[model samples]
Target: MVENINIRVANLQENYLIAKHLYLMWQDIGVPDESIQSNWLEITKEYIDNARHKLFYQAFIADISNTIVGSVSCKIFAGLYPNIIKPEYRKQGYIWGVYVEPDYRRQGIAKKLMEEAIAYLKSISCTKVILHASPQGKPLYSHLGFDENNEMGLDLS
Candidate 1:
């Protein structure tokens, strides 16, 4: 619902900007600078490299006046279930790196980015889509009809 915002599939030329957006997203979520500074660019580069060869990987960007203000990425997860299972049953889409600039928030840019990611996943026939919601982004995901799963975690540290 954001006026004049264009959402489109991101290309290799925009990987660095996507990485920047991801770094800002982590910072917004309170990740330590040391953790993000040393590795974010390299990590995102690797992901982009893999995405070039993997049909399951897709990224979307929200642009206004040629400036990217928001972004999202999705990857299809092929479950560990045996190959005997049907493909549709084994395929799931996992969304990540959803971020919007602080100045551009509340104008539905993130929502539009998510909708594009979801549509891409659906095009590949993924049976379900998933994403780990940040505290600030949980409401948007919920409004988009995402349900919480019983996933639990442990910190060995």
Candidate 2:
């Protein structure tokens, strides 16, 4: 494990860094910059703002000796379908933006961030936590006990 790693909840002022991490994550996974909007930072910031207001959103940052190396974001999921189920049985949380710098990866930074996010979701009384993992992230998530669910998608293009 990397020594002196500090994981802490992030405030609104750090949203820009979180957005930057997310953008880097997409690029790492082969998403072309040209495919992204010119105002991506503003878009991500707006989304985080809305989620913080309308959903129980929270973000975490990983700092090693005062330098930030990673971040993760989680919140109560806003489902695509009507959420009519009882909270006790179906309150689900969503985790996203699980990112770490390439140099800091494989040193457990992402794992620590994920652990922090999981604990936060549990504290919020979430019955389940869900995340869409990238190919490189699937193994780590699986090791964390995330099972494969029946979520199928198709490309219309």
lDDT of 2 by residue, 1-157 (tens): 8989999999889999999999999999999999999899999999999999998999999999889999999999999999999999999999999999888999999999999999999999999999999999999999999999999999998
Quote the lDDT for 41 in model 1: 91
Error (Å) of candidate 1 at residue 29 is 0.5
Candidate 1: C-alpha RMSD after superposition: 1.8
Query: What pairs collide in candidate 2?
Result: none
Q: Which candidate is the best by lDDT?
A: 2
Candidate 1 residue lDDT tens string, 99-135 = 9999899999999999999999999998889888899
The CA lDDT of each predicted structure is: 0.86, 0.95
Q: What TM-score do all the candidates reach, one by one?
A: 0.91, 0.98
Q: Which residue ranges in model 1 land beyond 4 Å of their true spot?
A: 78-84
Error of 1 at 67 (Å): 1.8
Q: Which ten-residue region of model 1 has the weakest summed lDDT? A: 78-87
User: To one decimal, what is the Cα RMSD in angstroms of model 2 from the true structure?
Assistant: 0.6
